[model samples]
Target chain A: MSVLDSRRGGGNGNNDDLASLEAGLDALETHLDTRASRWRKLLSATWPPVLAIVGLLGVWELIYRSGVKPTYALPSPADVGLVLRDQLSDGTLLEAMGTSLTRGGLGFLAALAIGTPLGLLIARVRPIRRGIGPLVSGLQSLPSIAWVPAAIIFFGIGDAAIYAVVLLGATPSIANGMVSGIDQIPPLYQRVGKVLGARGLSAARHVLLPAALPGYVGGLRQGWAFSWRSLMAAELIVHSPELGQGLGQLLDFGRSNNDMSLVFAGILGILVVGIAVELCVFAPLERRVLRRRGLLVARS
Target chain B: MTVLEEQRVTRSTGAVSLRGLTKRFGDGPNVLEDVSLDVAEGEFVCLLGASGCGKSTLLNLVAGLDRPSAGSVHVPGGRAALMFQEPALLPWLTATQNVELALRLRGVGKSERRVRSNELLELVRLSGAGGKRVHELSGGMRQRVAMARALAQDSHVLLMDEPFAALDAITRDVLHEELVRIRESQQLTVLFVTHNVREAVRLGDRVVLLSSRPGRVAKEYPVGIAHPRRIESPEVARLSVEITDDLRTEIRRHGAH
Candidate 1:
């Protein structure tokens, strides 16, 4: 009986024996996975999307070659790729990318600056939460495109109008993301934080903020998407010498000239930029947070 | 107020005092009522109760996380380390950082923090596990790491709310041994909460039972058994039966009403 009893009486000074017994306990207990490989993980993540794009391209080429719309009405993949090649060689593609990216970047940054505090306040302060919770939720569902005309009316045909459209479109999504994140934190964590003497600012910074990060990041991803789309809509509507030519303006110009290949190229630009931003910036950030916390499930 | 009590208090300063402690959330029925107990420095007391008996509520008050509706809770020290039924380790941090958070909050110097954290990890027999994330730990290991984290706070009084209840039977038994071993070495005053009859007898110097529905202390039993108690031993099993019968009667009263 004493042999099975791992706890020794005080003053026995049998720590070495206890440690060995605990070693035995550790050996019997199920151990968690020690590591997950990086490259295999990357491959598992990389293959499916690559295959999907290939499948899509194959279908698209078959339809185009079948003369479904008599070629001029809708261009072939080769025709779009040729236009892409010409634009890249002429530096027009890079110039347009710079213009659109600058607008989207500034717009998203503005939304982030305003929405983060608004979210923290709404999540923590009961009065503000009661005042704006429904409104924030309502705005989140409102399409960013609706803000285009209103932004034009307010700021007129300029970069200011484009920026305004992006901000209006994305702030609520960013703010609401923080709100839900804070709401979802397990109550036990808050209690533990309080017990550890973390009160007021210390509690919010150390406990509330980190705990709400995943949700906040989700908001940022949605907000970025909204900002980019709204900027495009605004660019399509407004034209100014100072605003410079962007991807949206290029698409609009293509429509006016009735150049189907140019239009397809514009569409491709928007689609590629959106996917690239998600893949390069937000997706990796979200994954890092999830992976560190063990919230991310490993894919085969 | 007695001379003997005052002398004892002076001899060992860290003690938890609850006098007429009561709690009711909002306009709901009382969660705990008129609970009074005193846990002396280095004493091990187990709080045993039926479901909804507000043993957790009592702990929250004792740890200063909640205000009692009536009466008071006084601690000799300003802080007491409290652990939940869940390990409640922050998923974002590795086990070492989880322990380090307590030390950081306590204002331990940055350079010394690592040494102290590793020492505490070793104390709980989680030496190499310090680098592991909370999710990378098994149930028992997480609880052990949590114990290490709780110890990091350097509080003399450790309040545990059924810290091992979620583990497997064998694992729980192993953790019980770990708890006893750690408590003995650290000379910690522990108020462990458990619903397990055998565990209450197996670990505590004294067991206090709470009746449900506006939980109040209904009974108390002292276990003078020697340390290294096996959960399945005959003496422990016998004491558990007696405590379980009393606990059942206390629970039965709520149903009778």
Candidate 2:
């Protein structure tokens, strides 16, 4: 007997019915991508942070007016703003920022290169994971600042020492992130990869790595933070004429000269740079990854 | 003839053949035991069993994801394509890219991969959804993309592990029709596993009921009902009732033991 006995007599009509039915079902069930206007979204996101900054400045001004500490010890917000403006006009602030940013960028890249492979090995190879898994976790928890003295002693207070400290600080977090990312991948994905004939390195590259990406991006953000922190700590400790003037060095310079405004200005610059990198670089990258995977729900 | 010789003869003839397959995990009871089955070229076979019957284990062994503890599984058709209960499409990739990944792994060239993936998506009636990400698609659409990906494997045998068990009833019925059309058009061999008796009756040319807990082949029913059989049809309902009764009896046997 023919399998398509019923279908053959009225196949075209049936197919059209099936097609239309499927379309109706899809239309009824599928989610429409409704979005608020871009300007409204931007305004909503920006206002709260802007208000918080204003409130913080107001409190700082109140404390200054109250004379809670000497002007030399605790400079007013306006005093710090003037110091920042002067440093900006004189080009020293930009130069310090440029120097610190270059170091941070390079250190973060180096950490990424080392950490990615280390994480894959730890995640995939059981014996290696068993051997070094706890050690990587321990390194992440240990204060990165504590490594500056050892790094200086080893590399002798140069750019090499600063990079060493940054690598020490960031590499563990990146590797740990990779481990957790790989661990979190559903076993079904691996099975799907296998069924698709993806084996060994191909499986790792195509399925495992991409599947672990959200976690890996999270790790990268943390790694960048650690790199910046370690670089600042190193600059503060290992100051020399040849080491160049970074934000940390600028802060150290203000301490030596007893310029409280410059000190506050240096603190402000560091805070701004950290926040800027997070807002400008990592936040967008993270949102893009999460949004692509539909992990990020629309605010509305 | 000896059992080995008989097994070899059967294995050579069928598109997929399992001879005395058994599996157990880490000193636990055998999940499957001495279960042998075969699917001829272009045949549609539904493996029906209760939970813990090792139906999934059987599919995994055929797909080469797992090894049989004792016996052998022979698929003359190389590397059967297996679909899970979930769509299992890569969330990072768009629908077309997910299918293309399968083609790329199969060694299809970059230029050809796009054309072939689009054609496959079209075959699944998802031509317009190639650019949509996994999460952007509805549940039914995602499953269709998965079906497209499986088709891209270019394998003769398709193993489905209850691919529609999670769908709403209406959607499931629609996919059942879609599956029938796709099977006929492709001339593909299918080995589908499910606990739903009516589903097995609706889709299969042959329904093989398996006993649970050291899963053994309990019975096989050749469904002689003509195609385009409704799930509610008398023929389909009658067979389903018989099969459900048999399944319940098998489960009761375990309780009695």
Candidate 3:
């Protein structure tokens, strides 16, 4: 309102009344939301998942006590918890997680490096898209575990083989995510860029890339899922003394030793890691991008 | 043809000149057919037509966003800046950043871009809203930011395709005045496209009516109305009625055939 009054003074006095009227209209029309405190918002969001977990544990305890299976096979929740504590005290669980996460992180970075340019090429170059678009999508559906045997033959049972499977698993999803992201950009943006004299590389950098970011982030999330799954599959299959233990290898060890509690602990570790990464990294990133664009409505 | 030949054609034309410009998509009929018009230096011309009359298409051709299938568009003023019905600001950038982008693309240095963008924002009376995101601004304010971005292009010819059509009546009136004030101070040659007859009459030096379905230039009316003209003024109302009658007749012709 003050800005409006200030603008009124300098302009032709004939339109001063009109300027003040406009300021009034603008102020009256805009609706401001009163947001809740941050702590309250966090508590509201966290309660549902916490309740669900507790309910699931209750069900699990009931099943264990039903005596439907032998004690060795149907270990109680407390027994599995004890196994987890034992592994934690010995530092083996931490080591296993560290190794698996390092591999997953490095493998995902590689997939991202390869996928971005490939996706851009497919999205933009008509001939390239026509030639390889189907092939890339086909790769996504073909399961990276199916490549383990070929990867083993090519690179042996080592880090290279594991990384190969991870890349093959995640790269297509990432690339496809990128392609879909670019496809969804409204044609209006491109026209605006052209009018602003942003041609070729400049258009891609400033206009196309930022506009396609939400979709690209979606792809990265899917790609991470694929990488994690592929790494676990490879780790379970390709165990060697030279290669350190991972969550998948730990599960394989438990099965061989017939320790049901250890096997459950390994499964829990894998699930926790996956969910934590999603909640901490991808969900927040996607929410930020969408919220800034006014695509996400703020829940009261 | 060659750049030399292109430069020669532009030199002989007005700020913006169209010579028999024809546009078509694939095998479909021409969207615009043999349409010709001109806007002298610092002139404001409103192209008035009904829906599907190719008003937007003509602006696209003039803005060089689309090319004509035949004939030429000569803009001696270099590339024309276009404003759409929607503000079309990038949602992620703040208002100043959006204006700065146009300057950056024009090869302005970093330090100069900042200063110039602030000046442009002030010109549109959006100085305080420079750091606000696109979504945070009201619809009318967003359009003002859009105007700032367009002005940052420094193009002599400004092509507007119903830029005020989406606004509320009061806001639109305020903007109409803002546009006129800006046009005068900047000495901009404006080609505004709108279907509202009164709006064309209220703002333009001349109103060009285009016939629908192949979009030919049907007629032209030069407004002798004085400046500071109100949208509800008697002269504007009389001209709007005449233009509306002609527009209805033009639309009826399509049904007869």
Task: Please say which candidate is ahead in TM-score: 1 or 3.
Answer: 3
For residues A1-300, what per-residue lDDT tens digits would candidate 2 score against the true structure? 322233222377888898889989888887887888889999999999999999999999999999989999988898899888999999998888888988988999999999999999999999999999999999999998999888988889799999999999999999998999999999989988989999998998899999999999999999999999998998888789987899999999999999999888888788889999999999999999999999997665
Q: Clash totals for all models, in order?
A: 0, 0, 0
Assess candidate 2 and give its TM-score to the true structure.
0.95
The predicted structure with the larger lDDT, 1 or 2, is: 2
Q: How would you class the docking of model 1?
A: acceptable
Off by over 4 Å in 3: A1-11, B1-13
Q: Compared with the true structure, what per-residue lDDT tens digits does model 3 show for residues B183-249?
A: 7667678999999999999999889999988998999998877677789999999999999999999
Distance from true location, Cα of A114 in model 1, Å: 0.9
Name the Cα RMSD for model 2. 4.5
- TM-scores for all predictions: 0.92, 0.95, 0.94
Model 3 chain A poorest 10 in a row by lDDT:
A1-10
Two-way lDDT contest, 2 vs 3, winner: 2
lDDT of 1 by residue, A8-31 (tens): 344345656656776776767655
Fnat, 2 decimals, each candidate: 0.47, 0.58, 0.43
Ranking by lDDT: 2, 3, 1
